[model samples]
Target chain A: MKHVIALDIGSTSTRAALIARDGTVLDHLRRASGHERGAQAVAECVLDFIAELRDRGLRKYGEAARGVGVAVPGAVDEGRGLALFSANLGWRDVPMRSLLSRPLRNLPVALGHDVRSAGLAEARLGAAQDKDRFLFLSLGDGIAGAVVTGGRIESGAHGFGGEFGHLRVRPGGRRCACGAVGCLETVASVPAIAEAWARASGDPTATAVHAARAAAYGAPRATRIWRQAVAAIADAVVAGIGLLDPRTVVVGGELAAVGDILFVPLRAAIAERLTFQAPPEVVPAALRDTASCQGVALLAWDLLAEAQR
Target chain B: MKHVIALDIGSTSTRAALIARDGTVLDHLRRASGHERGAQAVAECVLDFIAELRDRGLRKYGEAARGVGVAVPGAVDEGRGLALFSANLGWRDVPMRSLLSRPLRNLPVALGHDVRSAGLAEARLGAAQDKDRFLFLSLGDGIAGAVVTGGRIESGAHGFGGEFGHLRVRPGGRRCACGAVGCLETVASVPAIAEAWARASGDPTATAVHAARAAAYGAPRATRIWRQAVAAIADAVVAGIGLLDPRTVVVGGELAAVGDILFVPLRAAIAERLTFQAPPEVVPAALRDTASCQGVALLAWDLLAEAQR
Candidate 1:
């Protein structure tokens, strides 16, 4: 079957997958991202990983992969096919598409933002399937979001459209790393919750998962920290709803893994805060960790489709 | 000269215009909206106004108007051609398009929200011309907004998109008419500022314009009230910037008449608040009060083009 090679490169790990035209994952692979080595080394590592995936796909399918799609964290100039300024990867204006294409003998390559790519995957094949308008939020180490309208992500005028992490939910509250006070990321991001829980519970290793478990069991301190995080998230979501009026809010990331513990309070908090704004169904992401891989694969297929046209 | 008829119906007055294909207002007329008389009376008045404009168009141009577009305040279901609800008009489920169509022997009628239509006009021919993405804010008796992306307004899933006024900016600060606390409208809307200024200055007839003038002159009380309004508006605009990252923000309606007094501080406040998000060019609305009429005219032309297609 005709297929594409997809890669989601993060700070800690690189996930590679073979995606068919129908979005099926024919095969998957994972490896260290090697970003700590240096930007040049990370680039070389990515090229090598792509080469390995390509050789495997050629040998197994008896043909070459049609395209390559890579999802990278941080600022991206998707129109220019440049991975611009990723602090995690320590790269600046890396011509990722061209780099991938040269080794693959001119295969079409699509580069996308990691969170946005994941959002596209969700919109097409996961929780938001058939939903033309919705907000996709990833509450990982930091919060990120994508506004999907007409089944396409809005990349904004300068490709910075969905910077939901820095939205100031509390006036003059916690200082965010982005130099803003009361940013949603400072209160509701996975690490933020984990840190709060760790301090409050006096357990150095207490994570957000532990906090959620404790909150679910009705522990006082954990429940307080969990509720604060949930309220902050609801504030940001309500702001999104007011601006976009999305029908669904598909949440993905580490916090989302807590399932009903996060969603139940999130829905109620959002509902309680809303007066005139339409309440969107706050649902957990369906694709889990493979979302970016599947999403970039879909981008590859789209590139091929556009080329055909 | 081929043209379209356009009308903007507000609570107190209705403005009508003759618009050329290139978005010029050939002629204009105004009349009392008579909405206080009842929804039926308002509907009858609308039909009569359209008939008058149609007859005038035929007499002046020796041809019938190809289409008509009406901009109304309140909830609108543009896809279904229904004005779902308008508290100002005291109407519900008004089949506006069909009502206008039946009387004019089935002339095409396009229905749209007042602020959104104004935003469309701004995007096409006014302040935001050539801007594919921007936020259009109208600060009148109440605040309303439109999210224009790719040169079209995002009406949301349930026709409630772009309700920017209700966004919680202060968080538990003021009770809004919409039953929400700290809504942007509560602090920055025309009447809100006016109320604050009136109370502080002990002038019963004081308006937002008086406060702006006094603030410009550096009057202490007026300046305080004005600063509060500007800060609140800046907060809401910053939230919009974080979410959509628009290229421009076009401010209109009554408060915008203050010009430099509002724009100068607003730009500074927004700049101060923004950390990592791209700062959009905040500008005054070029079309002023006639934006809705021109926008509906554009919509009418669009309907005619679609019919030919």
Candidate 2:
């Protein structure tokens, strides 16, 4: 029985999970990212998590795994196995694979974009596993998306294929960190929902989840703001269906916590936008935040399988 | 040399040509589409063209061709080889393969959408030949597009892919024939350009090409309308780039006939909409209205090559 390590580095947290060859979780550990400690320090912390797992595996199974697979946020150069420009995670052009592999005595490591890795997990082990062509959309702190077609995710020319956030939802409305106005992220992401609620309710302390609930329940101000956010999401989703025409559309992240309230209007908005005869299936993501971890595990699992072939 | 008959059926006319195994055009013929003549009449005209080409080829080369290929102007099911619908040509669920195959002694008849067939031609012999991932956009009486990626065109799961006309450009501006509002084709196609010209010169008789030239030379009304049209096209182009991020984008059709008057502003508009990186190389299409015919030729050539393989 062989085992591999899968590390998922996010903006606020660092998580390491040991994935068995059979796709089962053996052990899991979590830690704060403390990204303020700088890139090298944070990476060293990630390495420490891997080392603990490697030692545990060696003591129990009498041998260590051959490699580790990691997933990081933002644009990635999958061919070169690097994470590039994750503004949230404070990482840029980090040779995550090389750094993680070097200290582990030449054990190979694979790196991929977190959202794309999550999409791969869905394609490999979740609801979209049987469906080869679909989109995996995650609306979290900031919005991001990934395209999975014919059993492989499209990484674009620059591995930035699914930056759905900056897609203009409102022309010249909200100025975004990307230096664009009216980006989808400004309207639909978790933080956006909270911000909109603050503006509407004048509370300034409402959580995004609670704000979404108030909006779903049809509070006048909450509903007004929520409707606008949902409308923007629908625009992106509708455009996506028109362009990609996938078999299914799987949505996750913090915004999806509202479930049917979010999907009902989102689906209706998309349907109203289409003039064509056919449309794709829209569904919530099966795995929540843990999806990225599973995706990283799947990547390691694939490498091991490929090596055997 | 083996030869195949290819017919490109458009709204106003039906053009036919004979292509050899080496991709050389043997003979070209033309006929009226006769929208007044109805479906049966149109089918007869196409069949007549193929028969004439077959007889001529046999007389000149002493052999009948292997098969027939027809590129129709509408929705097509390429895998099952069916022309599901055509708004312009008035074709609906036309079992083109069986229809043409029966008359031609049960030989294979390959049927495909004109825009997709044109994209195949561009990918095989035109501007996109050197690129693996590129988008072929055709702007004519209506807008249609095609994606050539990894050397294969994406036909969508239900054969409804590349319908770029329906992409919402202005959001709640004008109702389109496709039932969507603010569709790119509503404001950027040949009719749109012609409409702008008519408004500018106060001459409803002014053609799209002439109007484009007038606008390029600084006619205020023409410039205003043309600028709006350019901005709309740029928005749609940016949207497409954002979604697919292809390496190259090839533009053709009636709008392209405007030449540099169209390309210059259109390119600048697309550039203005881009952000944080490389805009794709936008160029004029190498193949013209005869694109579908050549693409049909490529299909026949592909079939013949595959048979040899």
Q: Pick the candidate with the highest DockQ.
A: 1
Instruction: Give the winner by lDDT.
Output: 1
Per-residue lDDT tens digits of candidate 1, residues B176-216?
98898999999998889989999999999999999999999
Q: Which ranges in model 1 have alpha carbons more than 4 Å from their true place?
A: none
Interface C-alpha RMSD per candidate, 1 decimal: 0.9, 1.5
Return the TM-score for candidate 1, rounded to 2 decimals. Answer: 0.96
Error of 1 at A240 (Å): 1.2
Q: True interface contacts reproduced by each model, as a fraction?
A: 0.77, 0.49
| Cα distance off (Å), candidate 1, residue A158 | 1.3
DockQ of each: 0.80, 0.61
Off by over 4 Å in 2: A37-42, A59-63, A90-92, B35-41
Tens-digit per-residue lDDT, B63-90, candidate 2: 8977787888767777677777776766
Kindly give the stretch of ten consecutive residues in candidate 2 chain A with the minimal lDDT sum.
A18-27
lDDT of 2 at A205: 90
